[model samples]
Target: MGGSNTSHSNLKNAVLAFLVPLPSILFYLTFLYHYQDDDPNLLSPVWKWCYNHPILLANIFFFFNVNVLFWLIGLIQSSHWMIDPYWTVIPVLLVHYYANHPLAVENKYNVWRSRIVTCLTWVWSIRLSHNYFRRENWQWGVREDWRFTDMKHQYGKCWWWVSFFAVYLSQQVFLMGICMPMYVIHLENKQLDILDFVGIAICLSGIAIAYFADTQLHDFVSRNKKLKELGKPVVPNLDKGLWQYSRHPNYFGEQLWWWGLVILAWNLGYGWTFVGSLINSLCLAYVTVLVEKRMLKQDYRAEAYQLYQKTTSVWIPWFRSPLIGKSKNT
Candidate 1:
């Protein structure tokens, strides 16, 4: 009976934790919509400011959402990872809004670009959300991420408040910065150019690589799990398939996709939009390095990973290490 009660309490926390941030975010977005629906010239000064600076308005939305989540995490004793899906979800909103924006939709070329970008974003969002949901188990606070748990231990109790600045707000900044290309795309490149076609190809190819890389990793993990259940020898790490060519194929693909977006932005002449792709790439590289460092310290099959690392390219698919095929046993 005690165990049952504990489980019920955890369930209640999880649902309530997830619910805490909805009202603030939804209300802000609704306000934005109402502002947009009004005549821009006739709007009051505050509405006029929001009308002119849509990105600022979006950032405010993100800031409020993260602050709410920050409070909720403390109140519910949940992990900061509960905010993970926002990375993919916010882009869906921004892209949809940008693509349908009155200024953008009237231009035929930009409309086509917006449609393509939006469709690709939706596909990316669906795949990412599906993976996050299953991995997080929809249990919210009950299933904390290992990374945040480790940080909490390292930071002591102060992580309760520190996480708002270190994790949630920082992530919000990166997300908005990385999404600048989507906003920029709506404003310029009134006509399609050769670079636009090239960008589309690159973006599509990157998305394909990322999709397949994730799929391969998922299938391998599932196979190993089944093998373990059957008392058969299970593989330790996935170093074959798309992974054989690159140590972090999905990370490379993710960076490539952003560069493709940057190319689209470049068509309008070099500007702040390029910062989005550049920072996003740098951040992803940082994440990849962090993950590799963590795995080196903790993975049981670290020796196997070292051997795999010798032959595989770190990010570029074709640039094999000089030590390639040096370890015949691998």
Candidate 2:
């Protein structure tokens, strides 16, 4: 009876999580559909301004519908969990928006590129969303990310205002910045070439790596949980498969995917789009440090993890370093 009730409650939460963003999505779709006709006279002053500035429109929508609205919802729920799922989702939305915008030139080549990129974006989104749900045991909005929780404790009363900037607004910048490639791809119409194929290969490889790494990590955690339940000692660290070569194969993969998109945009003569991927990579580097620090803080795992770190590459997969013996003279 308890198990059945838990399943039912999980399903309910999943449904609610899925529906929470529907209104905002619907509004965006409706706006895009109307904007497609491109009749300046038919649009309101606000709409006209938005039509003229598609990027600005996206930012405005994100600010109001996402930043402000989600912040309020987070306050009410006392958890900022909703944004984690949307991290996977928002890129899909942005790609489609760019593809459909008046600014996008719809030549045969452009349409083909857009379709290919959009499909890949969807694939990435699905993989990430599935991982998130699985990691959360299909529950949603019940807990905040550990980083956010830590910040909350650190900030105390200042968290309310600090979160607006640190959590929501910061995300606004990063998401928009990282998605510049999608916008550039739509804005410029170029013939498909070798670089496009290269980008596709890199993007797909990233997705595959991330999928496998996350799966392995999830399995490790599950196994550890079971061991704990049975009163057995849990493995201190995972040092198998892809993890053997890199401490964060998943982060490396994610970076490859974004950099791949930047390649596509660069091929289209918008090399500036590389800035987004670069910034994202830098942020990920910082996150990797934080994650390692947290891992070392775990007493049981610290010594083993430290040895693993010494031998393992941080991001890129490479040959593990040999352990050096200390010299008596030294």
Candidate 3:
């Protein structure tokens, strides 16, 4: 019984790590196929504008280049993206697929559905891509993804390959896979239902929360950059805004968005889609709880963050005061 139990445990652990990043598989296969040949065309006015803003163009190029790098990593190390799984969404072009396929017109409304999703995704991607490249000293090689760095160091030798690919690369793949709700449903050639509206609303709300939290954090942190120069309280880490509710609200909202995608997918007739998102969230939540409980708890021990943690809910805004609270600035 003991031996059998040990075997079962090993099997469970193996499967958990393996399937965690499953979506990247589909992304790598589907995403690269579009590059088989390029349509040669002169630049449009918009293209010319994009070229003029070289930095913005470089940002977009960097992200797409990152996409290529991710696939290359998969090809080389058989690894997956653990931190940001949505990186896989690039290849599937799930929305683009449904928007133009001959069958799209069979359900014209669904075509619009795909367009909406594709639009939102581009907006988010463009924002993130530009934001990343905005950094002056951006370098590509051997960058540390906080989570993966810990995992790599933890496994050291014994399960290095498994730790690298299964835990890391699979996350990227799964991100692409789970992002399929909007694209896949459009492909199904069906009308959008009330569920679609709910999903859309939830996704949009998530975007707003994520953007707000990120912007607020950046502003708050940067606002005090001068103070840090003067030697003071910024790195003390203010918890005035959404940071009040949870130590890692940005990460929480991101987790929620993927789960929102999962929910939307499930509503679109894809059963068990929530399972994929749930697992992703659970993994992230564990990481967040582990890290934040130690770090944030250590830093913001009693005053603001702990007060917020005690009072405010983490992800779901069940009951709370408005985020528009008094800040050090105001």
Candidate 4:
């Protein structure tokens, strides 16, 4: 009857909404590179690898497909599995291999391409993972990132689902797109040139800038926590190192690195890669604004933060004078 038709229509809409962005994510994943297993992706006229080597294949679950429904469920359960983020560094390199470089055979790995990205991604992944693993309560449920909680709090309840779709799913899409360059390297027509070399240098510089900025911030925060634990004197403001130049040097560097990805794609002629960087840049800019407002709430040392603000730039690095302007608005 009418009820049955309505149910069917709702089901169709749900399916469509769920899958709207899935193709783009996977397209960037496959259009640039082929994800392979130790046992080749294809079957030699017989059966399958999943049946024989299920555990090995399962170990690569982090790189496997996910859906928005899982994302919703994760949020409802207060679980990280909904987003299921992993060291996408490897996935980036893997996809870049397919995009920029052509394959000689069906199942062979390109030595030069694989080696460069694998090393870089591994180094970055190890550095980040090691830090999180070292935290005291690194258990699965308890080890959630506070950044996610903060976002949930900021958005509030009524708009939660919208926030999940816009924030988490959208971020995953960018993560997939921005990484296409790494895999797109396989699809590149031209051989290595000065532009390529320069692009590589910029990529490295972006890496260094992001790493140091995050490291310095983490060190600054960790020092405060240590002081709190030891009952020692603590500095409320992080006006040292990268903090002296900008209120959000880490966010700035993160945005810079993503833009560097755009530059690499431009050099490689995969302009679509810029789409992800564009989103990341805007989001980071928004985060910087939010951080400034959040810091303003701490009236305990209002003058100290004001002093830091007065002498520091908000988004860009520049010499701040005591007079001219304290923040981005000024």
Candidate 5:
């Protein structure tokens, strides 16, 4: 009975997450369409100026759109999960906007670059958004991320404002930084070459690896939960397959995916801005540390996490110790 009620509540939360911002998003899109179309009566001088600068218009729209949704959901549910899907969704939107620009269709090389980047980004975004939806059970506002919960605990009442500036805004800044490649890629007409092919391969492989790792982890975790609920002996942790090789093969794959984009940029001679990928890698490293720290604090799995950390690579897939020999002996 208790489990049923909990499940029902979770379903409700997920539904609310889907429904809450949907109206606002629809309204915003309608407004944006009219604004971009330059509806004669509704067009203010400022908006007309904005339409002339599509990038600026897009940046502002997304910034406010995300912020408004975050604030609404955060205030209602006190959770940060509503922001999860935007990380994948935003980049695709950005790239799509640039890809469809009139100039993008003018040159053969530009069209290829635009198509490749957009298609790859769309593929990645769909996969990520699917993963997030499944992982969160679509309960965006209800399933607050543990990191945000910890911050709330630390900040007490002030987390409301702090989260806006510290979490949401900072993430937007980082997202824009990493998206520099997509932004600048449309500026050049460099034909696709061997490096671009290599980049595409690497990007696709990274996505596959990450997707596989997530699926494995999901299966293991779900099985563990079911065993626990059935009052049976549960698996200690997910330490088989890819998890055996790295504490975070998914994160490793994620880093590789960005570096793959960097390779695309480098092939076009868009140098230095490839630093975006480096920044993304550094951010992923920080997130890995945070996740490991959280896992270490779990009373049931602390020692196991420590052992895993010592034996497996943190963000790279490899064995750090002779666990193979120990396993064979056992």
Candidate 6:
């Protein structure tokens, strides 16, 4: 009965999570569809102003639609769980939004590039959304990322306010920055070249690598759970498959995808967009340190994880080094 009740509650929460932000999404899409091409005479003063400055308009929409609205919801729920799913969905939204903006150049080459990138973005979003749902056991709003929960504890009473900046505002910057390439993609109509193909290759490779790595990691965790249930010794760390080469193959793949997009923009003469992927990579480096520290703190996994760290590359896949001093059995 308790299990059934818990499942029912989770399903309700999932439905609410899906429904809550939907109106904002629909409104944004409607606005874009209605104003795809700016008409000075037909538009309201405010709409005309926004239509002139699409990027600024996007930021404004993000501020209210995402930052403020999500913050309020988080405050009410006491969990910033919604942001995880949004991370996957936002890039897709930004790409299409930019493609449909009046500023977008509608040439044959530009249309081709746009369609390719949009399809790739959809593929990436679907894979990530799948992983998120699997990780959360299809439940929503029931839990937040461990990092956010830790921050809440760290800040105590101040978390209510601190979360606005730390969670929502920070995400706004990162998401917009990372999606800048999509904005640039629509701005120019350069002919498709070999570099475009190269970008596609890199992006697809990243998606494939991330998919496999995440699958391996998920299986590792599931197997460990079964081992514990059956009173057997669980594996201390994942050191097989792609995990044999990099300490965080999934993150490595994610970086590849972002950098791949940067390459696309760079080929279009907007190389400065690399800043977004660079910032994301640096942030991931910090996260890598935190994750390692967490692993080391665990008594069951600490020793083996340390050994694994000594042998494996941190982000890039490479040949494993010789064991530092002695084998685990020694």
Each candidate structure's TM-score, on Cα atoms with residue i matched to residue i, is 0.85, 0.92, 0.62, 0.66, 0.84, 0.95
Instruction: Write one digit per residue (lDDT tens) for candidate 1, span 252-313.
Output: 87777777877887777756677767777787777788888776775666777777666678
Best by lDDT: 6
Q: C-alpha displacement of 92 in model 2, angstroms?
A: 0.6
**For candidate 5, lDDT tens digit of each residue in 1-330?**
987877787777667655654553564466467665766456777645654665676567666767766666677766777667678777886787666543344588877777888888988898888888778665444466677788889998888888887668877777777777786777787777898899889999889888988889888988988999999977666788888888788887777788788888777777776777777788778888888888887877777667777677877786568764564312
Q: Which residue pairs collide in model 1, if any?
A: none
The TM-score that candidate 3 achieves is 0.62
TM-score, predicted candidate 1 vs. hidden true structure: 0.85
Show where candidate 6 strays beyond 4 Å.
Answer: 29-38, 324-330
What is candidate 3's CA lDDT for residue 127? 48
* TM-score comparison, 2 vs 4, better candidate: 2
All candidates: CA RMSD in angstroms?
3.3, 3.1, 14.6, 11.6, 3.8, 1.9
Give a tens-digit lDDT track for model 2, residues 115-145: 9999999999999999998998877655788
The better-scoring model by lDDT among 4 and 5 is 5
Task: Give candidate 2's whole-model lDDT.
Answer: 0.87
Q: Mind giving the per-residue lDDT tens digits that candidate 4 earns over 272-310?
A: 878767876776677777777777787755657777777
Q: What lDDT does each candidate get?
A: 0.73, 0.87, 0.54, 0.55, 0.74, 0.88
Off by over 4 Å in 2: 1-16, 36-38, 324-330
In each prediction, how many residue pairs overlap at the backbone (N, C-alpha, C within less than 3 A)?
0, 0, 12, 18, 1, 0
Worst 10 residues of 6 by lDDT: 321-330
Worst 10 residues of 1 by lDDT: 135-144
